[model samples]
Target: MSEPEAKRIKMADGTKAPVIGTHNGHFHADEALAVYLLRLLPQYANSSLIRTRDAEVLKTCDIVCDVGGVHDHDAKRYDHHQREFNAVFPGSATKLSSAGLVWMHYGKDIIASVTGLATSDANNDLLYNKLYADFIEAFDANDNGIPIYDPAALRSAGIEKRFSDKGFSMAGVVNRFNYAATEPRNAAKASVSADAPAAPKQKTQEEEDTRFQKASHFVGEQFVAELLDKAGSWLPAREVVKQAFADRAQYDAQGRIIVIPWKPEGVPWMEHLYNLEEENGAKGAVLYALFAESGEPDSKWRIRAVSLEPGSFENRKGLPEAWRGVRDEELSKVSGIPGAIFVHASGFIGGNASFDGALQMAKQSVDM
Candidate 1:
């Protein structure tokens, strides 16, 4: 099918709004999130949302997602359940759900708008990729019924079991809204089945619409919360981390360690540092970072090893070998730093009772 021309709805105030349509009866996280993402754009900020499966009703909407039979991006029909449909995002093994499909096409613009970062900003791309890896990928994988681990491979490797189950994820929360007193909680389970027909409804159409609205509102709040953290908290820290990286030479003559101003909490420092090094063509030049704790005494500081990647335990440069598995006065004695508190046995990080002690620990690790 060819792409349809965009349609706009005129609000009561005479303002134009996009009309977004999805299936009715039951809602899931993928569709809820997809709708929320569309509204994040300025063009759709006050869009009218319609919940229905009526072919004629969906035809009147500007974009029909997760319900229409077609999966054409140009046509703005984003369903994935057709037997012949086997679409996946470029470079991704998992099939795309409505949420993933929307994100793949519009995530950069949505993230840029939410974070107040210009489309051309370097961090815009970084945040977009990070959000997908950490947040959106699980939605796509779960909707596609991809297993977290291959059970056969695990048994062959002598692994006894996977440690954790999928807990109360966002998808689970959305499904809960469909619950009604007449039906068992499991009734919502059908929402996850790509080809399962919608379960018979126990509630009136008015009641079902109310529940869908609640689910959409809940999902919208979640989207906003995550966006605020990424923008207000994380984006600001990138600047601090970048500056410390650029000034590493002043912190230590060898330019191996960076000392950032105190921060209230940890951010994506490792990722920012790694990206900065790549951009400057000085990969692996930074080894450690020292920063004071906000609202703590000036004597307290944290000395952290720069990880090779975010969420990785491996470090570009670990603490001195002698300091490993040492603590308190003993650590102080061996390290020749009086205020040394402890070094994690894993060598990822350590604590010191004074700024000078932490600085010495990071510098000595670099020298070692």
Candidate 2:
């Protein structure tokens, strides 16, 4: 929509729709995602958006973001560009961007709106933190220009990237919407001015605003997709992990092995496992987990090592070294267990054709 046309949009009841204000020139992923996130609320679902840097105009706006040089949560100002600003998400070192700022204040409400959970629910708080850490923080880190790793540390460790993946991130995708003059608007006129310098072409205010809308929707789609997956798939898996953890003694008398009776793809178990372990005062107690490889009856069962920490690559304990990379009848002969499939070369995981075989592998590995 044109800038003039969007100056004010009235609600259905003839009341003035609340206005969201931001900078006008070019937009970035932080502000784009910020605006989209705000619109997810009931009050702002039909709110009008005004992209401008004018302080007076922003003063009249119900909410201002990424342009107003203020970070007052009570006043609904969420800009992060002020020289003195150093606000980060609670308990996190990464600095806030407009996206993270918006999320910090209104994330629970947004989660409720999308997932129909009570705003005060414990699960809502879980998702609020989970979504930020897994998804929203990247936008904050990118907009603030924070590298994932300290460059000096990476260099000191002699870790060099084998190839470049420039312009391949979600931030890069959003940046593609920024206005660029692919070719001069009037090439012939510029050619005629051989001796004089030609002024660079620029997108009109309306064109720039439209691109901003496109960019917002682009990031917003991804944000919603991630939120839904967390709420729908990831949240439910917490219960399964909790149950399996509680039933650990059924598989191992010493409670060293937990069993997931059923197998579903992409089940997130480690974080919940660690939390449960700490809560029950059994931290670092679970060494192995056994579960069916698939829902199919004849499918193999897997015996896997538990990680030392949630999301860590290192494990607390690995399968026997003798079983590593051994497969089929040879694996069965080496372990003296029937229906053996193979063990991972790293010994983090192994598979067998039946639940009893997989269970025996875990029991033997624990002794080793």
Candidate 3:
């Protein structure tokens, strides 16, 4: 289907399509993302976009964003420009831009639309919170000019960045779509005498609108990609780790050893394991995770030591000291376990040829 037709709803009364309004001229990432996010819903997917600063023109819009000077969800006006506006997403101190405000209201519905999950589903809530923390919060902070790091702390520690990373974010990409701020001055200098004042040459509404659409699509596609990754890959791994943590007793009475049937590449289990431990009211409980090595020709299994904290290199418990840096027949003889492959010098991980041998290694470690 053609793009315009896909975005137009058939009106029974023959009225014009619902209009989503924002200010015209140079655009920023916040309103661009806000418009794209609104378009994801069934009601607004077919809506028309109108960019203007005229109050009368804005009043004609069904929903206005980033220029209305007011935020009223019931009135469908989301703007963060007012003097008293200090609105933020619940539990977050970073100020909301029009993007965060729209997300604060319609984010769950957007997630449900994209992932085919009910808004009330626990998994939907999980994705909603996770996406905001991982993806959306950055837009909010960037648009509001909030720095991610403490400047004073960096100075106090005498820390300096080794490389420049400016303009490397999605927000930076969106900013590049804006009409050049220097174009007007350059045009006036070339076409008119310097002695006389010259009005700046401005892009027509249609030209600016085209750039806005491009910017919106760019940010929107990125948002969807992040959402899909969380739903398709991350959530499944969360379930796997949750179930394994719950079923840990079957592998050992201490409930310190969990078994994973298999591990998928780029799918994490440690973060989930730590969260599950806290949820189960037993922090730092699990010490080891056993899993079959995925797609290996020799049917190898591995036992990994769980860190004392998430993202920490320090393990809660390591494998036997005697087995560290040992391999093959020597490892088998040292550990008295069959089919042993090897153990890292750090003892954070070890390998075996069978699930039984892996489980036996974990149980022996638990005993030690």
Candidate 4:
């Protein structure tokens, strides 16, 4: 028997074609942009952008979209920006979702400085696309830098009905709300709370020292914990390096104790992809860091400092000469200590709000 032919539907106008809205290539285009940026900067370990979320792309795309300025076509450069230094992001001070945050504390000129990629002839659309493409190099979800559109967070803030009423899809307007609305006041208090003590126009040097000491100790702990959590099977070593920093008495004279765990053999940790294997036969993956750092997988990396093995050296090239990864490079640039930290007033971690806490709490002054 012959099979029935397919039934085709046509537009009301009888144009004999499908009626479909234009697929907003915004999200897909954003993803493409992100992937492009990540692919270019393979030199920086932090450039390992990994998130594929639509909302993230939208948010990042939004930021890059707004960037533009004067350019000198003759020089073939956008402008003289401290591109090298900004490329070396000294840890961010603003919350990630606060797209306006960059403009609030940082200037648009700064974006041009590091990007050196976005040009004067380029408009917002082109600049945004270029920035998005550059961003995908390392989109760590856990990093506050990664734009996390939590629908639940929106729901908590009465955003579900708001979004529904506005006729915008969750994907379109997800990153446009204030998640932590109560933080600005809290940060103010931390800076100028004088209810119980003698008031001063500015925080005394002693207060400054106290803040750094506590925050750095907290940072070191968090780093080690994060590493162990990422390491799959390795545990932090019970032994810690016993030494005190000469600057202040933040830690003990014997030293701030740091523990190193046993690192496994032949594991894959190239470009934020950590594949661990036990000496015995244990096999499985562990945590996925929002933003984990890694060197070139193809290039042999010297273990400059392991979470458990401090001051340890390894020869990635094989014998005699030993070279190690610089674990503290980024953090040291931001805070004096290679791995120092700043905690938020609220105890929670891994959110942009908490990152602002770092900015407010860090004893160091904001240079930019």
Candidate 5:
């Protein structure tokens, strides 16, 4: 016989909402995040969530996730517990969980929606890949119990043990909602409940449901906040950085250093520079970035070293060694540049009291 078709729930407002079902009792980050991503899409924005393990209830859900016995995307069933099931994204070695599965299918559309970018926009792919590498992959690896490295290999390499403690991760945070003893051990001992038929358990299924609801909300809030930041703040800064890079020749004759004008706040510009570099095949062309201090007086400008890669501290070219740790008049005398403020001891950044002096410092450092 053919399987029974799933049903949709009708809201009080007379609008129909798809029912999303997951297992009850205990929840995890994977399902929490998966549900959040699903709800972000227009099709599921007003969907109702049903938390239960009953086969009848699950069968009535328009879509089942994390708790379903099968993993069939076309059927709208997403679960990874089956013995023969092992699915990984293209070009990835780690197996996917419910969260990853959801992402693998709808990630591009979700990112475009969240970032307010058209699905055809070039940066959508960039942001999607970056987020997966930095955030979603961890959820997939954690859910599948995949270690960063093989424990036996590490042991053979003289690493005694692996640190499995990850108490701050999203998964770790969701696990906190699991049941714990309501009464203190000392209090329970004092009560002595052996004769009283286990003192009718105070915590109920209602409470578990409440906690699951709260956790799902929390995960959804975090997901929205992160994507908003990437879309609103991080992505827009790319154009500003690109324009500054294109105008590098106006700032310096060699076009080796890009100067960014003052802004009220700092922006993430380095990644954009790297992306531009990769596009132009001009890797290592620009060695330094000079920009005005965000909130500082007009006299102040900051010069920063350009790193070989995003987030890496190692710079393509550091400031002159002689200028390291020097300040004020001494720095001016050593570098032979007027308005020299200070150069950091580590040589990653330096300051000047004037824009010309900052540009001069950058040029001189490049020559050195």
Candidate 6:
């Protein structure tokens, strides 16, 4: 018999769907935030640090819907001094944790993410019990607990794509890109290079390799620009995209810019992937962890279920079957996003399947 169909859950949206087990199926940041915050929504209305705006936040959400995250004081404003929580819990020291989260909300979907402090190197870098217990206790605190949270200064994390609302793509080095267009806020300044003639070209293998390396670097920079533009703080769009690829810092430093496709490194696949050990020529679990460009933790994220829209598959014959459900089994189970908001991501998987050769083998398995 076909595998038991996904259990559908009823929602106010009028679409009856199966309720995905938060345990069996990973609930990243958005889903985590939604579940956690929804449970706490009834309390935000009475918080002291929360102004009328914070209270409005509770009223605006789906009561039982996803608001992205609690750490996202920038997106869904929270009551900072609510007695228990970090007061500045969502923002404050979370620094890169917040920026990383911003990138996820825009470029990714299928899963969501949330940031947490990992005090123990054990428990595989994900102590769910530790994180959950900490959040709930702090969130429920009453007096000296909330030491510093300013309502006027905070919004949920996934609100904007940047530190500020207005944002733009950035590229420090580019040729095709025009820099002369935007008026430089500062006076014109130019640097001079030594007046030496460039060396003549030789078709040496090393030279060819250097040229290829430069090209790859340029491409990577361009991708970063797109990531910032689409997922910047200004976008205020939920969802996150991350990259998971060969750890070769020399080649792919950003990992793989994947939509939610797999687990973070330490959970299970870290041993094989991190060590690059192909024991007996057998591949290890495919671990894909794409991060936000900003410093914050990834919020909403998921692994894109690559598939054709029914009959559309016949017309788009060239579309790889692997692109749809290729090697997603491992990933589908645990997309790293924690809270509720959702977005789609792809480049991350494409990178890994290309480098690690897992996706390619998976495709072959399906075709056979």
CA-lDDT, candidates in order: 0.79, 0.88, 0.86, 0.25, 0.81, 0.28
Point to the candidate with the largest lDDT: 2
Off by over 4 Å in 6: 1-121, 124-129, 132-134, 143-148, 151-368
lDDT of 4 by residue, 102-161 (tens): 222232232333344243523322333322222321222222234346667887988644
Per-residue lDDT tens digits of candidate 6, residues 246-353?
332322233222222333321222222322324323232232333222223433232222222322322211223324333344433333212212222332222232
Q: How do all models score by TM-score? A: 0.78, 0.89, 0.86, 0.18, 0.83, 0.16
Ten-residue region with minimum lDDT total, candidate 6 = 19-28
Error of 6 at 203 (Å): 91
TM-score, predicted candidate 3 vs. hidden true structure: 0.86
Tens-digit per-residue lDDT, 244-363, candidate 2: 988899888889999876746557787878888998999899999888877888878999899878777788999999999999999999999999999999988999999999999999
Instruction: List candidate 5 segments past 4 Å from native.
Output: 1-9, 12-15, 54-56, 112-115, 149-165, 180-204, 252-254, 295-297
TM-score (C-alpha) between model 4 and the true structure? 0.18
Question: TM-score: which candidate is best?
Answer: 2
- By summed lDDT, the worst window of 10 consecutive residues in model 1 runs over 1-10
Task: Indicate the worst ten consecutive residues by lDDT in candidate 4.
Answer: 236-245
Using TM-score as the yardstick, the better of models 3 and 4 is 3
- Superior by TM-score: candidate 1 or candidate 2: 2
Worst 10-residue lDDT window, candidate 3: 1-10
Q: Candidate 1 clash total?
A: 0
lDDT of 4: 0.25
Provide the RMSD of all predictions against the true structure, rounded to 1 decimal: 6.7, 3.8, 5.4, 26.2, 4.6, 26.2
What are the per-residue Cα lDDT tens digits for candidate 5 across 83-178? 988898776888988888888888889987676777788888767776676677788898899977898898788976357565767788788766
Q: List the residue pairs that clash in candidate 1.
A: none
lDDT of 1 at 232: 78
Considering only N, C-alpha and C atoms within 3 Å, which residue pairs clash in candidate 2?
none
Overall local distance difference test of candidate 2: 0.88
Q: Higher-lDDT candidate among 5 and 6?
A: 5
Weakest ten-residue segment in model 2 by summed lDDT: 1-10
